[model samples]
Target: MKLESNLPKQSPWLYTAPLLNTILLLLVYFLFTSDFVVQSGISVEHPESNSRLTGFDRAHIITVAAGTDSALYFDGLRISQPELREKLKANREGERRAIIHADKHAPHGRVIEIGNMALDLGYEVAYSTVPPKS
Candidate 1:
């Protein structure tokens, strides 16, 4: 005795639908979960310089903002000069280096003061500047 089957063959799309859906879902998931690029640090218009220097491997960043207020930032946090001194003293285990990011419009006296403070703390100081626009 011979037996006959009565099922219809499925289309190629039916076999691929789940895979396509999984790929599309993965794409959407990554698009929604991934972090976008953000510009970090205190905004400052650095003075132009012709010379280029390598950045320190491990250093404290002191940012001096423009305007009459002349706000001071130590390692991205707003801080007073004395507070900065204390913080620097506390973080003296590693290489002692300070990078000053001063705005072009910021007062020269304040920059000098911070530089002096860093020097007093026995830290090698370097000023940050942008390359001259050609």
Candidate 2:
């Protein structure tokens, strides 16, 4: 009679990717959905609504003030169209989300320009608007 010996497989840490991926995904989910940081230099009293949304990560805000020229201010500094594009390109890292806050009276083209800039930077942009109360 002979007795067989059985040994458990080694490297129990092999199934780490799924757990790591899960942790990463959770971090990203929380980071993307939760607005923990407040962006500076933007001066718009975001309209009150029932949505109660806060903010985003890796976002570039282009404020179109109420004026005829429709000057552009990025982080409190005036920037031209070409320069704006350059800044967005340099700052963006493929995935992005931008919120446009334009004066209700401002030219629509101005907001489009901002969105275009974010698009050119490869960011997922979202327009910031006052959601109606449900």
Candidate 3:
């Protein structure tokens, strides 16, 4: 024997509506709560400065990380000063701009040396710095 009910039939979407809404809510929550940092290459704590520089290209970027050993990075790769010099020499064409993202704790002399190298190569050098806190 079989039993039959007189209840109305429900669409399949009725069962999945709650789940879809929950997934959508979770996606929206994560998107709003997440931090989107768009920096590439080695991470470093930039020093704060009151001055601001604008309209500089990032084709050539050198990162000077903290500590004295193996702290130089070019194009996201750890490189030596000599290797950096060679790379800069190779890309001497087009817009000659070198943006240096030096860590606040990095050796000041080393940062200056890198800047000098870029300057000697006839590339306009700019140091990356965070805006001063209010």
Candidate 4:
């Protein structure tokens, strides 16, 4: 009497299954752990502070970028002062809260002027600050 083979033949894909699974797991781990920073419109060096604040996600962000022109950016768009005034006036109809991110070396007067404009438009302004280095 003839006996059937006990061992099954393995396919090429099965040989690489373990390695594929490990690679897939590592890809997922890095994707989940990598920090995703939402870049505000402009780049600025936020001053260090000891105070902790609440959410700024819902608040409008106004960035004061220091350079030759010292421009203002909102929602990643460079807007003129007149345009900013108009936008703020319109936004005041809704939740009037703003987060100002001014460069550490930016003109204090310009930043103050922007903050005052926000306030006058009924916006509750908050300055963005980073934690002091350890």
Number of the top TM-score candidate: 4
Model 1 lDDT on a 0 to 1 scale: 0.86
Query: In candidate 4, what are the lDDT values of residues 1-134, reduced to their tens digit?
Result: 99999998879998799999999999998998775454685768999999977766578888898876779987678898789999998774676788888898889999999999999888889988899999
Superposed by TM-score, candidate 1 places the C-alpha of residue 46 at a distance from the truth, in angstroms, of: 0.6
Question: Pick by lDDT: which candidate is best?
Answer: 1
lDDT of 2: 0.70
Model 3 Cα lDDT, one tens digit per residue, 25-87: 999989986754325468899999988776674547799988857388887888999999999
Candidate 4 regions with alpha-carbon error over 4 angstroms: 1-38
Off by over 4 Å in 2: 1-42, 45-58, 92-95, 131-134
Clashes of 3: 0
**Model 1 spans > 4 angstroms off:** 1-40
lDDT (C-alpha, whole model) for all candidates = 0.86, 0.70, 0.85, 0.85
**TM-score of model 3 relative to the true fold?**
0.69
TM-score of 1: 0.68
Which of 2 and 3 is ahead in TM-score?
3
TM-score to true structure, per model: 0.68, 0.55, 0.69, 0.70
| Per-residue lDDT of 17 in model 1 | 98
* Model 3: lDDT of residue 8: 100
Q: Which digits, one per residue and each the tens of the lDDT, describe model 1 over residues 38-127?
A: 222899998999876665746778899999989999878999888998998898687798889999999999999999989998999989
